[model samples]
Each structure stands twice: as structure tokens, then as C-alpha cells.
Target: MSPSAVVNKRAVVVEPETTGHKNVKTKSVLLHRHIHYEPSTVVAAKGNYVELNSGQKILDATGGAAVSCLGHGNQRVKEAINRQLDQVAYCASLFFGSSAGEALAKELVDGTNGQMARAYIVCSGSEAMEATMKLARQYFLECAPAQPERVNFIARKESYHGTTLGGLSMSGHVGRRALFEPMLLGNVSRVSACNAYRGMKEGESTKEYVARLAQELDDEFVRLGPQTVCAFVAEPVVGAALGCVPAVPGYFQAMKAVCDKYGALLVFDEVMSGMGRSGTLHAWEQEGVVPDIETIGKGLGGGYAAVAGLLIGHRVIHVLDKGTGAFSHGHTYQGHPVACAAALEVQRIVREEGLVENARRMGEVLEKQLKERLSSHPNVGDIRGRGLFWGIELVRDKATKEPFDPKDGIAMALHEKGLEPKHSISLYPGTGTVDGKSGDHIMLAPAYNTTEADITLIVDRTTAAIEDFFAQRSYH
Candidate 1:
């Protein structure tokens, strides 16, 4: 039970059979990710672990896409959901206002200290992103002088907004966008991402790298015509693509400055890195620049419910307030009471227990543990992140920064191996990281309430699983 005892334990090095490529047969009724796949059926979950029907207890390392910030099966959140279910579980936002919805929105807006004036709750991050895009169009039309010429948006390359058509159109995630390109809108364009690991040029200072990225944004706006741009959108700390990459210092400020010069809004997609992921309630808080419109998800409800919201900055809210006094969009479940109540209590626990601060403190511990254990490894090209959200990029050649061939399927291999009987540790896998088509990495986003034991165990399990993987690989 002692902290030092926990940290000092020898790592459980899972064996090399963690390759996970048996071409196993399946009787699966559900079409899980792959064709007729039969993965371990998780029948129960508690705390940071899920139990399979085969009696395997897997450590929930990535929090199921970083959604279980409060950890699994939280009794308090369950109780809150029960309370809301008793009162009113469902109410159309178009017709009636639920107290849970209003109170949660008020609490969320209050957390922003009035930087954001309104909250438009939705069922998912993709929906919230679609809303942000649609609202941006309405905003320009409703602005003074009614500039209809503002029809284009500039988002960063390798960034992920969401999976819906509008969201896909706004996103430049090559892997995610490839299949949907034909159906996507053509108004959005992209510039370089603000990743210093691979983006920074040879012998370039951080200042020069940021300056060049800023210039790229400026050029993109110029190419699109300044008057035609409606907004410049990016994730403050990128998720999925490029693997937990945060912009260089002053990066957001510089990008915001360009948006300001072009009379365009600055949008931050915090769907994966917000709500206490990066040691702050909002990742933008650490960057020192507020976004004109921000979309948040994943941790918003702590996975207690499918919930996401658009946090409208004062500028955008003020424009809508003056012009329409009503948003032109709404869903049947725009502000579901049960979902709102779950998120509200989850956030309340976060605030009362000081979990965001815990994220900051524990993040340092996790980062240290990961680097100490994996940084010197040949394939671990880089280790980078903040708060509890971290990533380990795998490469074929470390010195040249050459990534493994996509056919190697390294990230997914580790992903599957982590779930093998001996390891039984869940990890988040990402592909097409270097260019949206050829990079491999494993993301680690644990709970904000993760304990020292959880951190140590995560690091240990991750080390074991990865080591088990590379041992059998002939990546030459």
C-alpha cells in the first residue's frame, strides 16, 4: 500500500507471444472493428480495470479513448444519474428547459470565467464540431455588413475534428478523411500542424519553427482570400493525429493574431484534450489564448453518458445575441437532463477533489516514469505530452526519425498484444501519425483521479507490452 513500495516493484514483462496475430477463428455476433472478430468480452468493470467473461482483468490504461477521467463505475455519478432519471430523464431542448441542463451549462460557463458565454450541449464531439462549423457560417452572415464572402475555413493538417461530414471536411486527418473525401464539403483548407518533433526544420530554433508555422497560416489565409475565411480551427493539443502533440510556445497566440488580422474567428477543438486532460479545465488556458469557439467532448461526461458541448466565446455569443437572439440549430437531445446531470456531478467531483491539479502533479510522475523506462529504447522515437495525456511514438529508424511502414501495423499490434491473456492491459493505438498515412504511436491518457499505484502499473504494463512486441519484430 506504500507509495515507494508500489513504485519499486519489478515490472511484469509480458512474454513475446504478445504479437497478437493468430488469425484466430470467430463466432462473434457483433462486427467488432475487424470482420467477425471475437475479442475478449468484458462483462464487468470497476475502478481502472475491466473483467472479461474469460475472467481476465485488464487494466484500463487509456480510459477508453480518455473518457473515463473519474475512472470506472463511479458511484457518485451513478447516483446523480439516478437522481436525474427520477426527476426528468428526457426533455426536448427546442421546447422545455431542464434544470440539470441549465445548471450544468451555468457551471461550465462559470468555469470559463465568462470567457465563454453559452454552452450548446450535444450527443457527441462530432455533433458539437458540426455545430461549431454551421454556427460559424451563421455568425458571418449575421455580422455587421453581412459579409457572405466569408465562406472558407482554415484548419491544420493531420488534425482531427470529428468523423461526420462537416467535421471530416474541417479535419485534415488523412487516414480518417481518405474514405470520406468525396462526400466532404470543399470549403475547408489546411496548413501545417504545429508539431515541433517532426515539423521543426534542421538547426531551426523553436522561435523560427513557430514563426514558420505562423507564416504558413498567413499564407493559407492569403491564398483563400482574407475576406473569404470564416475561421481558423486547430486542436490546442492535438489528439489521435501526430499523437498528443502540443503547439510550440506562443503558437496559439500567433495563430489567433492571424485570425484577428483576417477578421476570422479562432476555433479550438478540445474534444480529446479538454476538461482537465492537460492539467487545466481547458487546454487553451495553458496556451494563454482564448478561442472564439471551442468544442469539448470525451471527458465532458467522463463516459457516464455520451455528451459534448460547444463553449461559445463571448465574441461569438455576443454576435449571435445581437443578431439572431436564437441559434438556428437544435437536436432532439441537445441538452438531455440525464447526460447533463452525469457530466455536472463528474465535473463537480473534479473541482471539489482538485483532480485537475492532481492531473498536473501526477502527469509529471507519469512523464518521468515513461521517459525513465522507455526513452532510451531504440524504437521509442519520442515521448511527449502534458498532464495525464501522453504518447510514445514508435519508429523504424530513431536517428533519421524514419517511421515504420504502415504495413507493419505496429500501433495496432501493440494494441492487440496489450489485451492478450498474459498482459491484459488496454492501450490506445494511432496510425498515420507522421503524415496521416505512415506513422505509428500508442497514446496513454489515464484518469485524472489515477493514483500512484495506477501510474506505476500503467508504466509497467506499457513497458512490458511494448518490450514484448519489439522483441519479435525484424523492422529492418
Candidate 2:
């Protein structure tokens, strides 16, 4: 590869990729996050290890935003995609449906054990969220009595839905929404998140906290006019936006009660925390509340294919079934046959191999290791999550719970250092920009099939990375 090369007879500037995203290093014709950053080049990958062209092997801990559940180069899924290609690869979703798509959708619906009535497969998490947002509006119109005024959406602060305009409007993530504030839909209002570390009053008990949070949601609905509210969108276990914060005991039940009282739909955005990443097949199952409309991605296809889906509850399906008899939204690539086949194969393995149980069991080991090692660190403020999903909040002063100054760039530094040659382990990190909070957070979302030994290696390398980051900062 030269600094300037042309395949299509055009000039191109080639530069190394940024180490900011897992030691990426390469020159390519793609628009990366930062124009001057270069990351390592991945030559190959097997199981949980990714190989770089420079011969460095990296332990994949975060699974690339918690995707890649089946790990790298899964032969079964590869064969499934190849088989689908031999038959039919692409088909217009609006005009026809393939057995591949139908089979995958049936599997998803059956996985819910009939709780979810229909499945609409899409290409990515953002698109799934964008679809669900539109579907909610359409659903109301198709209801027995059309409620056109039901446009207001209530979402919690410190939550992320997606990056598209509609998804951005529903999300409370600070940085991503700043650039499009003027253009984002203003119908979504935010309330306090169910984060116990930040939201709990000094003397409040768990029961009291639940009640207070529920009251806050009810109040928001009332303020917005109950009949005007469309839905309350949230991640059962908040994802990158809040760094894997799981709502406390009785949290979802309480929230659902509020939604029921107001006749607003309850939507769970399980893109990051669903599909066995959090031990259970669906994170909402653990919360004891089923969403009216659920959006899932990332782990859904396990990075074997581009796939995400919307799971509609029985009520929503019935309403639409009785009315217009069709959903008025879709993408060009909706229900792509090859993608569905790949996802279906990936899911089959996840179920047959018992990876969900492994995630639950290994999650205990992973969490215990993190707490035992870092809970006493001066900068460590909190450790909270469920199953394989965990997050560590880094504060400058644990006593005061004060976050490090934003200019310190602590989160990205910790992330980059963890992926260095010595560490050779990939991790996830969050700043105030992504999480809508004033602190640094590091997320550990390893593959669902990870072992005790893998967990141990991750913890050891990560602890060293944290210590090194702080020590180097002290020297400065």
C-alpha cells in the first residue's frame, strides 16, 4: 500500500488507522472518526483473539460494542451465509419474503414463547430503533380509536437509543445530540434515569427509590398530558449511554405501572444488553416486565451478519392486525435473506451450545474479580451491572463522587492503554459525552462464551492498565 494509490483511477491519501479503536492501523478509503488518527490493522481473528498485521494478538473483551457474540470466524454461520447465497441473496422486502427471513423471525418470536407476536428484521441497531419510533406513531393511528395527539415520548436521562434523528431525539446522550439539537424532534422529554449510584437520595431505601422514580415518570406523563404521550423508551439495562446501569429491584415493574396508567406503550431498547449478552436471552425477562415493543441488535446476529429486529407485543400486533393490516415502514435491506440465514445460524449455536447460561455463570466470576481488584482503588466510584454486562465508574474523588475533569480525557486514555501491545486486550470506555454523566466509565462486555481463564486474563490486564493510566497522569 502506497501513500497514494488508485484502483478506480483516482488519487487517495493513505494513512495508518487510529489506536483509539483497538489499535487500528491502516490506510484505506474510508472516513474514520478523526482525520489524523490511525488504528491497528486486523489481519485475522479466531475465537476471542484478533490478529493484527503487525503480529500483535489482542484479546477481544468488549466484542466490539458487545457484538460478535459467537467470536471470530464462526464456520457454522459462514456456511449458513454461503448456503443462502447459493440460493438467493437479496430480495425486496416490500414485495416478497423468503423462507430464510421467515424462519429467523419465527425463531425470534418463538424464543419469546409467544409474548412477541411479530418480528421485523433490519440491518442495524440504529435502524431498528428508528423503525420502532415510527412504528409507535403508526401503531397509535391504527388503534381502535386513533390518537393523533400521541406524539410525545418520555425517555429517561442518561440513556441512549440511537444516533439517527428520531433515535437521537429520544436519547439523552449529551454529546451526540448537541450537533443536531435544532433538527431533532422536540416531542421527547427526559426524566431521571434509574441509576442508583447517581439518583438515590441519601436516606432513601430501595423501595422508596422505586416509588420516587415511578412518581417522577408519572408526573412527566401528566405534565405532557397523558393522552398526548406515545411511549416510554428505555434500555432495561442501560447501555453505553449510562455504562451498563441496571435498574434496581422493582424498577421496571414500577415504570410499567406508570405507563399502563397513562395508556402509553413501553418500549425496551435492548440493542447492547440483549440476546444473551446479559446472561438471559432478553434482558427484559430478568426485570419481570415485558415490553410492548422491543428493539434488539448487536448481539442478535453476533456480528456474523448485519441484523437487528423489532419484536412486537401481542397487543400491538392485534391492534395493527385489526386496522390497516400492515406496517407502513421498511428499509431497502429489510429481511435480507443472507443476513437472516447467518443470524439464524448464529442464534441456533447460541441456544444449542448453552452460551446464555455460561454468560450468567461467568458473569458472577467477572463481576467478583472486578470488585475484588478495583473497588478499593481511589478513583473507582462504582461497579454495577448484570450477567456479562458490567461498568466501572472512575471518579477523581471517590469520597465526594466527583468525576474527573472532562479535559483529562481519562476514559479514552484508559481505553487506548488497555489495547496497547503490552496489555493486548480490547475494552470499552465512555465519556460524559456518550453516557450523559460527568465521569469516565469502562465497560466489560466480553463474548458470551468466554471462560473463567479468559475472564481472569481480562481482569489482570485491565487492572494494570488502570494503574498505569493513573500513575502516568501523576507524573504529568
The RMSD of every model to the true structure, in order and in angstroms, is 6.4, 5.4
Task: Write candidate 2's Cα lDDT for 1-476 as tens digits.
Answer: 00000011111221111334543454666765444445666899999989988898988888877888988999999999999999999999888899999999998999898889999999988898889888899889888789999999999887778877888788887755675789999899998899889889898999999999999999999899999998999888887776788999999999999999989999999988899888899999899999999998988898888899899999898988899898888799999999899989988999999999999999999999999999998888898888899998888888878887766667766877887898887767776622463567888888888899989998999899888788877522
Candidate 1 local distance difference test against the native: 0.85
Query: Candidate 1's residue-wise lDDT over 1-476, tens digit each?
Result: 00000000122111111222345567767654344334556699898998877788888888888788998999999999999999998987777999999999998999898899899999898999889988998999999979899999999888888877898788877766665678999999999998889888889998888788889999999998999999999989888777788888999998998899989999999989999999899999999999989999888899899899999988888888899888898898889999999999999999999999999999999999999999988899999998999999999988999998776667877888888877878888877789887888888888999988889999999999998889978763
- Candidate 1 Cα RMSD after full superposition onto the native fold (Å): 6.4
* CA shift of 328, model 2, Å: 0.5
Total clashing pairs in model 1: 0
Best by lDDT: 1
Worst 10 residues of 2 by lDDT: 1-10
- What would the TM-score be for candidate 2 when compared with the true structure? 0.94
